[model samples]
Target chain A: MALRRTCLAAAVLLALPAVPAAALPPGDAQRGQAIYERCQACHSLARNRSGPRHCGLLGREAASVAGFSYSRALRESGIVWTAASLDRFLANPFKAVPGTRMGYAGVKDPQERADLIAFLAAAGPCPE
Target chain B: MRDTITSLPRRSFLTAGARSTLSAGAVLLLAGCGGNKAAMAAAPEDDINILNAALGAEQEAIAAYQLGAESGLLTKPVLDLAVQFQGHHKEHAEVLAKTVRDLGGAAVEPLARYDFPSGDLKSEADVLRFAAGLEKGAVSAYLGAVPLFAERELAKAAASILGDEAMHWAVLRGALGENPVPVAFVS
Candidate 1:
């Protein structure tokens, strides 16, 4: 019962509808640019490759892209891409959104994750 | 079922139960267990039905873990997580049951005694492998539902659980000398 309670507490904290403020330092988009190289292997701003393109990722509901074949978990996650969500997810992809198909293990460092999200938020839309 | 859930704080109960897993033992347990077919068997079109299906999957996982734990195949880390995983499933079931009931749907009652096949328990490694497979299936199950829920909240909740299942899969896979995360995409 004690174990059960602890686990429940953790999950509830994760599920709470309203997100708190960003915990890490404000992101450095320039630093994030350097960090995005790893992500660029599979993700790009304009076109989908092995992973879905990252163009205009901020404020988007996960897996809302028209043609990409996102995993059901991503489509159903119901998370809007806010800074807090992105930082948490980038730090640990599987933990933030379990069963996600995205291959990246996670960023691990808080600052790097913030920077990455900063870069993503600034990625803007693909050229028509 | 209603009584079991009402006693605890709902959010905590559900999340904790998510920690538990019914695992492969469910597949094994399904060989003989039974439920109130009429009340629990939900309609295909029902939004609650999807939850029921997920609940059923979690129940199966609980039985598997219970059987494995009692069989004494696991020691130290494995045993601890197996029990923890079972607790997670219990939370999942508890939360789903309440959600259905709150929405004017029947809660699916789990079988009284899921007959888990005994011979499958040979070694700790074997137990881990079985658990890993269960976690993997769980990931797939939740993944499939991501696009099916009419409400975005339901999808998010299911996705959250799927993430936990995926985490379990990775740990078990790594323990068994397999590549825990073999692919970029989880599917």
Candidate 2:
């Protein structure tokens, strides 16, 4: 009876979707640099344009950039940039923050998103 | 002498003697006044022009939403959402027109008919895409206009409208099963 119960539990576990050991896939920063070209239309490493500068993106709070106008939704959103957070945001930004001013369609490819995240992570740390 | 000065008709007196000289002097006087007026009006004139352009775009948005609402391609929540967005555009148009009037400019009227891609709007998805495209264009246009306004208040108002347009664009993209906010910034 115990053996049958264990087998049932194992089967149920197997039936569930596989959870990845890591939230993000292995990314190539080099490839991500190329992907970052699309972001250049609004963002820059040094100065704010249509969007805020991205030099210190990782570990930064959303809408924290000085002097850049941000949407009320993003300004109120208590999001801190992290690998997992960025992965989700890069996948579907509007879903993550409903009224955010970002008009992008999101990167659907997990690998590409991972690569992009990696590139941003490597861009630099948050300013002191 | 006083009787003669008072009895002479003003127009006849000016025209009877030295007509060419009087005409030239009058022209110069008018020209001087006109140039000064133009200089003083230049800033507001620019704001009015920008406001009129914004009004025209808002009118276009209202019409586009009307088209989507009547297309039979949308149903339920989507139709309702389209109507709501149309209301927003109407409000935008009203504000823009009023601002133009306040600035002493004639607000531009909407085109009798817009040249939307009617051939492409065959399905609900197509309609959504069309609306999304317009919203995106509106966002970009407002972004460009925000900095051009001489009135800081007008620039702020435009930025506020731009935010609304960006939200609409995101919602339309969401309806299309696309990532609504794919980018970290609106370019």
Candidate 3:
């Protein structure tokens, strides 16, 4: 009887759906805009400051800006900006790109990182 | 030359001054008891070690600036700026040394010489770039150190120093005709 019950429980457990690993919280662009104040010190959506412009950061190739100088590490990275890649990069820029010149310590909080990414996604592409 | 490159910002100095004063007061308060009691209340071992590391870096910065100043690689206005930044590092070292002593730790002393890339520092631009790189590293180091302190006040003091270092980096970069503040965050 004990063996039968154990087998039944194992069968039930196998029927459950798998859960995703490290799922990020849903981002709010408005909240992200507020959090972006810290970023304003070096970045702007339309113009480059200390860092590259953010107007079309999402889906943009790393170090593709025409005139801005990029660190060799990033220029050679062959990165295409996406939510997932940006998430990792924004979490820790130094760890993500060893020699990238983005001097930011990175956004440590996941939700904040999500929101900032959302804001960038919503910021629209750079003007032609 | 841009004002940013020619002189330290007044507000940055004022903020550093106020924070240093507060930090000094906190150290004294921590050591208010007699010598034996104060000894018993020393900061955690890790904090002292970290502070000592920061002090060593500050000392190196002082030495590096002195070398640049004496090398005759910098122009008049740029040399003046380097001296001003060196003064800031001196103030930082003084505060760190005092805090270490107040916490019953022996402060780290400056070395007689530092191994800077002397061969590369042939021009004014080269020296400015080297100084800027050091300042940038200092900013990153302080950023990493700020969170590791056992005492919140110590963290705050480190952050204050970090801000000053960032400013120096920015000014040096500007002097080099590069963007003074390239990133929103110091890594």
TM-score of each: 0.46, 0.48, 0.52
Off by over 4 Å in 2: A1-128, B1-42
Winner of 1 and 2 under TM-score: 2
Q: Interface RMSD for candidate number 3?
A: 11.1
- How large an RMSD does model 3 have? 15.1
Comparing 2 and 3 on TM-score, the stronger one: 3
- Model 1 segments beyond 4 Å from truth? A1-128, B1-45
Question: What's model 3's lDDT at B26?
Answer: 46
- Comparing only chain B with the true structure, the TM-scores of all models are 0.74, 0.77, 0.82
Comparison by lDDT, 1 against 3, better one: 3
lDDT of 2 at B58: 82
List chain A TM-scores, every candidate, in order. 0.81, 0.80, 0.81
lDDT of 2 by residue, B1-187 (tens): 2243235477775565333322332233223322234433546655665676567668878888899999998978999999989988887777777667656667777777655656779988998887887777677667656665555556656777888889999999999899999989764
lDDT of 1 by residue, A56-120 (tens): 78888888877666655566666777788777677656556654555344676777878888888
True contacts kept of 1: 0.00
Using DockQ as the yardstick, the better of models 2 and 3 is 3
Candidate fnat values, all: 0.00, 0.00, 0.00
Candidate 2: residue B106 lDDT (0-100):
78
DockQ values of all predictions:
0.02, 0.02, 0.02
Task: Supply candidate 2's per-residue lDDT for B148.
Answer: 54
> In model 2, which residue pairs have backbone atoms overlapping below 3 Å?
A104-B182, A104-B183, A105-B182, A106-B182
